[model samples]
Target chain A: MDSTCRRMRAEILDISFSSGHGHIPTCFSVVECLYAAYEVMRHDPKRPDWAERDRFVLSKGHAALGYYAVLAQHSYFDIKEVAGFGAYNSRFGCHADRTKLPGVEASTGSLGHGIGIAVGMALGERVAGRQTKVFTLIGDGESNEGSVWEAVMVANNVGLNNLTIIYDHNKSQGRCLPVTNPGERFRSFGCEVVEVNGHNVDALKEVFARPATGVRAVIADTVKGYGCKTLVDNVNEWHRKSPDAEQLAKLLEELHAPAI
Target chain B: MRRQFKETTTALAATDPRVAVVLGDVSVYMFMDFHRANPGKFYNMGICENSLISVAAGMTATGMRPFVHTIAPFLTERSLEQIKLDCAYNQWPVNIVTCGASFDYAWDGATHHCYTDLAILRLLPNMEVLQPGSRREVDALMRATYDSGKPTYIRLSDHPHDVETNLEFGKGTVLREGKSGVTVMTAGPILPNVMAACEDLDVNLVYFHTLKPMDRALVERFRHDRILVVHDAFGLQEAINEVPGLRTWYHGLPDQFCAWYGTVHDIRARIGLDAPGIRKAVTTLLETPSA
Candidate 1:
């Protein structure tokens, strides 16, 4: 896993493992990509509604733990907010709620909505004569939704060079679901596909740095639980299962404290 | 009706810069002039209703007042979720204008029929539903909804209109005012049918182009009298339910898929929504004593 994003993952683990109701594995899978994307995004924490601020929506919304952690790490809220993960009046919902949270651009637990919304945001910038860029992250499983392809075709037809889509390709069909080929499919939709190691923060940063052109997509290849040994070995099997107290200790030991 | 919508959309763009249009490639020619007039504001978003709605919401978030148009079934049923979550849940003001009301494309078969648009959109808590019966009402309601700053659903029907009346949110205009304790109320192009039905009777006739904030005050007028709701849909039932005690007889398409295909008039006859059928239903309600 990218060391720069490891701390964010640790925060995510604590929130989800403690809440006992979160997508820990899915959140872990996209940490490196989100960390890299959030860093290079032209956004201001104080001015969350800044008209020209770069917009990011997690279409793979189950990975809200990681998204919330990243926002907290960016100082959108205090780190202490993570402790109240799924609390009754928490700004952070189980899925990202733009209404509740400051940094969240859209509420997106429903699999395949983010891309189209992002496309509209890109078009909004065009209409207003602003150079703001819109970015979204989707899952390998989410591409199965026809709305994703619908937006893909619209984005292609509209020539939205200011939009960027990052697919966290964890191959998460879970045996029953077919592992769809997002890279080739995206290419067919006329997106400029660039594959990167999602675990490598530097590589993700470099891929994102290449200025948005022609509705580009970054197929970040990574595993569902990259660094956590118990979760990493078995892909997505321990996804929804929150760790027990004993398991949480071992997870913290491996993720938080390096072997001195 | 489509031509009027296109003209109104162009006129709206001329006055309001925030007005933008996105269609599902269904009405290409209808928007050509608007596209030429407002370069980046009008977009033919292809035949993707889900994307069209979400994209409209996205544009709304960035301070753009976006109006989406497509077939009734495709726009309402296909993208209902997006309309609920993306537009209504977020309180983003999106103007959803749908053509092919009920079965405007009767020969196109069951796939094109949309009898439950009122029910479908009414069930969603956030949408304000409007159905324009005449050319004047269409222009008035469209302009009002665009400037209303709330998510709205407008149905454009091929039904002709002779009455010229103003529109207000949650209010109905009294077309043929009467105080015989029996009022015939309806919305959309069907208004003409109800008028034809009650043409010989000494009864009240009201038209509610807007359904959501239904003119509850109008219900007060018919508090003790019987009501003949012509296309009585969506908020009418609930509004009537609230009038303490009153008699209501509703006539519209039934709650089943239109089993056969024919002209819109034939389909209306089959479903008992034609002028004669409506008149008969109103006569029956008029005979019933208010208990």
Candidate 2:
């Protein structure tokens, strides 16, 4: 892994472990994709702030540690801010604040609302003659909000070709598996649905690189915890758990070592 | 009042290409002139309040000024998150025109009655809440929202009344001046009720059309030891919370869902929002001793 991606992963593990929230593992998987995109954008001087630069929105803002880590890696803001996560007077709260945080396009913690905002953003850019693509990451459970479908209908009706919505299908939100498949639900809304293994970085990169002719929905099939052995494949408990001293020690060791 | 909003919004849209109107399925009956004049700029966003505001936000981002029109309850409560995040947090210069403030939808029952809109919308930052006292005030505030380049919430009464001659944005106008034993502050259609009650008592009548960026200067000028705020909204709790100094009392509905049946007049009479009730409240306040 590159230095920036490696450092960001380590930061996510540390911050999430400190918060006693196990959902950081899910965040780590998404950060890896964001870091890869940022690295490509940084080296290319010709198209900086290019209207076509990939846009990322954390629709599931509860897992914000992952987003802050990735943003730091991209030099969007100071990396030190990640340490202030959930602190008093800190901009880095449990839910993302778009106004305070650089690279965060929308403030979201409320379910089913971000996608609608993203749809509007995408449509606005298109109408302004900008070709920028808008990507929003939604939780599987959050798809239950009626407003999400309201947004879906609008996006499709408006023909938002540059909008891409990703569902972090982690299967569990605090308790049980999602009642339905987000991919199927999105398809019913007249969107192009792509289901893939979310943890596979290369797969994520490929899916993100391919732009849709119309509004697309990507269901990233992922486990709640995909890396650490104890947390890996565990959905319910790791959705949010503060790491104890022993667990923290083991996590630090695992992150320091190379990926198996 | 609703006709004034329609006429003013249409005029604004005609002159400025950046100005657009989004109707929440109710504009078909109200905004005929706007739709006919500016077909390209007008949108029927259907019955979805959430999508309506989101679309307006998008329009604002694209350098278009958007005016969203709907019933007060649907416009303020149903899409509250959109108002907070997309409009207020982003600081978008979108105008929200809500028709039928208070118990205007008296026959539609409690669900349609909007009694808490002002109390909730005023709390949001970068939002200017205006409850126009008459059709003239509605026209003036609509023009102000267009020119001010700020987010505005305009509450319109279904029952139009005589306009306050000297209405100004951000300033409360004195309708009646007297030795201040009791000062009655009100807005929207309730301004007339307060004025009628001012005849018997040594009452000062103040019309508070602009709720946000409140007229603190005017509110501080009253020497009255007793304050009575009469509003069509959920009593006068919100108004009392905004001003300081004298002991305040509210004359509106209690903290309960509005019941089905009765006209706006009947509901106001039942909830003690009539002129007699307002005068009684003012009298009771003047008699009470300050602790």
Query: In candidate 2, residue A19 scores what lDDT?
Result: 60
Residue pairs with backbone atoms closer than 3 Å in model 1 (clashes): B170-B213, B170-B215
DockQ of each model vs. true complex: 0.77, 0.40
Runs in model 1 with CA error above 4 Å? A235-237, A256-260, B177-180, B232-246
* Model 1 per-residue lDDT tens digits across residues B1-291: 778888998998998899999988878887899999998998888889999999988898888998899999899988889988888776788999988877788888879987677767776777888877777777877877786777999888776576766566567888786656888878777776778888887788878777776777877777766776767334456545556767776777576777487777888788777888888887777676552
Q: Of the true contacts between chains A and B, what fraction does model 1 have?
A: 0.66
Residue B272 of model 1, lDDT score: 71
lDDT of each: 0.81, 0.73
* A1-260 per-residue lDDT for model 1 (tens digits): 45657878777777777777678878888988888888888999999999889889888898988888788878899867767777788777788788788989988889888888899988898888888888899988898889999998999999998888999888877566665777898999899999898888888888887886699999999888877777777655687777888888888786755531
Residue-wise C-alpha lDDT for candidate 2, range B141-202, written one tens digit per residue:
78877657667888888786795545778888877776756677787777777777767777
What fraction of the true interface does each of the listed models get right, in terms of native contacts kept? 0.66, 0.39
Tell me, by lDDT, which candidate is best: 1
